[model samples]
Target: MSINGQPEKVENIYLTTLNEILDSIAPQNDLELSLNSILKILAKDLHFQRAFLAIMDPKSEKLKLSITHSPAKIDHVTYSPGKGVVGRVYETGQAVVIPRMSENTDFLNKAFGRSDEELKSLSFICVPIKKGNSKEDHNVLGTISVDSPILPMDNLLEHKQFLEVVAALISNQVSRLQEEMALQAQMLSQGPLLGGQEVPPPANFVATSKSIKQVLRQARQVGPSRATALLRGESGTGKELLAEAIHACSPRRDKPLVKLNCAALPAELVESELFGHQKGAFTGAYQNKRGLFEVANNGTLFLDEIGELSLDAQAKVLRAIQEKEIQRVGSEHPITVDVRLICATHQPLEKLLKEGRFREDLFYRVNVFPIFIPALRERREDILPLAEQFLEIFSKEYDKNIKRISSPAIDLFTQYHWPGNVRELKNCLERAVLICEEEVIRTYHLPPTLQTAESTATDTSLSFGEAVAKFEQELLVDSLKKARGNMLQAARDLRVSYRIVNYKVKKYNIDVKKYTGAKKNK
Candidate 1:
């Protein structure tokens, strides 16, 4: 079969590939779906007379033939330890190449019940699958053996090597798949917090998609610079997290990090909060107060919601940043501050400047370096992992024994649009954990907004269930980030009872212990 002159059979199998199998496996979470799918595709694509995979049993010390592509009407055969080439190679954890069929006695001829004479024209190759670690324990997870009659010696060896490569690929893919799957299970079961995993960046930090890697690559560049940085994105896109990350990676990481939420503070307090005030400078000022600048002296100060600052406040900020000194509200002398400024805003500063809501000079001052964070919808690939992370966090916080987010719940999450970005997703999952009674967070427990958004988007062809699932997945992961895997604390932050939270812990089956905790101040 041919499609556009390419092998149609091969194309069909490759095109039929699904990521579900990959989603089912995790580090210790073993599932055979991914391995099976790869073998299926390989067998069909190469038109091999017989193809099958065998993974070594963890405790059995025996090679278990997990998948087979042999013709029906024949029972599948299992080789005893070191009985045949496949078993011997698996046992020794090395590659064994059979140059010719009749040369080796250890080469069993029991594949698909084929007689030795009939199988004589066929050559085989087997290689052991190994895991990465200092110890490098050799385990024969399985063998990918291909049989072909009337094949050339060179072609046979090449195909053998190719099959070995496929085996290695399967091993790696399985490892990732199992890890991801286990993470998902843990996220859902454990209420997004269990065993104390470090909370991840917000769901708005989505980067699982192919396109978002470039976005992250660009964002990473802004960290080392002394120039003022501007981060632009939709609200809930986790501008603050990115800003903090930048500060953490900067040269002044050892200094205090002062954050000013320009939008949250009143206009009267903005100037004083930023530049400091002398005693009796204002009606409530009985004593001198160090502003964010003084507090962050020689460190980095994050100015969030910069677009919300009034022109007057913006002017004061501009002066201190440009001159490296700030005069107190009622003081005669200017105090020097060696602080680095990193600003973030969801609003389009350029548009605001054009509309006269933001000052152009201030814009230019902070815009010396700009980092744009992509929205959750833009980087759907990161959704599920992030969600799993959140589930792990919340599970532990709520003190619930929940294990994971149900498959359907993940599917639902990936389908919705996160209008509020990571923040909104965090609220939604917290709510779900509060309401869910099962070990897993299911579709019924999802936020009403998510369901509504998914429905509306699907109706208009604007989004699909799969997309929402990805979004929710990211949000769930983001929520687990704050506590560094301390599920009980995560639950308190979410304001949910411990039991419900623990249910999610069990449902997602997350191991919070693996979450890397936040490093202490160096």
Candidate 2:
């Protein structure tokens, strides 16, 4: 094939490309999915002839082949210990590379039974994977082998080294997964908390979606520790609320949890806000004032929009975290503070780092543990429950008798894509509850955008209509509510005549006499 009219294929898989693929699969909670994605990328995207991993079955104690490339059909079930190249790599815990498959007697044509012509040009590479990271604890559990027939002869060594790096990554992931599964099993065996009641999720947060549940799991895991948590998501996705959950479940719950928005403060006042200034620090410094770092001593300090901090502010924050102390502005005295830091950002810190706007050192310091809040559009399962919760909250606050959302209103609630996430949903429910005169909130009582076709312009599928008559009916009802069901007064408030108001009220089947006896808002 190399001597034909076509040029030879080169092996040019870079480490960066491999890392990018692994990074994507890192978030996957399923072990089978992660392994399939790894092999799929190797065969399909990396242009390999065949790729597969042979993991040892725990009960059978034999190396069994996993899912392979779609083009190749291999019927071999399990390899005996120290038998073929695959078994030899697993038994001895060392990788093996065959420059020419047909030349080696251990090539084992019985495994795949390819033609001699194909075996003459094919190169085989197998790398053993260990169960743990330490070399002293070498428990060979599997082997990831690849058949790269199209590669040039000189690139075999580089490819072997690349496979070793991949095997190391596989080892790390397997070890972590095994430990996590063991811990979970042990916890479940301990049973529920006191009174047989299940441990409730974080307070004031609904986690119906799997994505948000995973975020909550990650947050609670790091709560008791002093590790800095980085909450990442788009604006209004409740990063601040998640910060509160982390602190509430943490050991610092007894201490005061200080909060600050890095973007809300002026650039000149950022340092003074983070680290206090002396009484005579600057022209405006009349009296000594402690900063957030000092105020949140022995507690959690949540810094929202940390990405908006200036480069100089980032440097000082990094120092405070590293040294466990901070120097106030225009003051040389350093005060020690024991604070648990939780940083949040809606902006991409990596993009800012590459653009020279953010310090790379500070970026690494705060990115220790990251929890991403799924956007409302991605977690639609939580919408109805959240809407109901907000409905109850606003009803009590506004002294309204609103009980539930109507079926049509619920349909519109789930159909519309919330761009502002939980914050927007809260506001939408609050508005709906306030305007709702009847026990239930109707579709017309919702925001105008939700009823229009604009809601469908985004990711949603509903291109619902907004009827002018429905809106006019709502206006008439509201005016009647304000006027205590009096026709002349309601018409004056609506800027229409009494005859037109009476016609609309009768046309919409409105019972004007009921509102007259009920207590109304001022």
lDDT (Cα atoms) of all candidates against the true structure: 0.66, 0.77
What lDDT is obtained when candidate 2 is compared to the true structure? Answer: 0.77
lDDT of 2 at 136: 36
Candidate 2, superposed: residue stretches over 4 Å from native: 1-199, 455-522
State the number of backbone clashes in model 1.
103
Candidate 1 C-alpha lDDT tens digits along 1-522: 454566655334434432433333322233355465556665555555666665554445556565664553445456666778878876676666666667678876665666667557666667666553212435445556666554666766666666655555466544333333333343344342323433343334545665455545444445555657777788887777777777776778788888988989898888999888999987999998988899999898999899988898888788888789888899989998888888888886757865888875576567655677778877767778677667767877887666677555676677877777677777777787777786667777997766566443344543676667555444444345445667777678668777856776665566666544742110
As a whole number from 0 to 100, the lDDT of residue 94 in candidate 1 is 68
lDDT of 2 by residue, 205-233 (tens): 88788788778777766676677888999
Off by over 4 Å in 1: 1-206, 454-522
Q: How far is candidate 2 from the true structure (C-alpha RMSD, Å)?
A: 9.6
RMSD (Å) per prediction: 23.0, 9.6
Q: What are the clashing pairs of model 2?
A: none
Q: In model 2, what lDDT does residue 452 have?
A: 79
Span of 10 residues, lowest total lDDT, candidate 1 = 21-30
Q: Poorest 10 consecutive residues of model 2 by lDDT?
A: 190-199
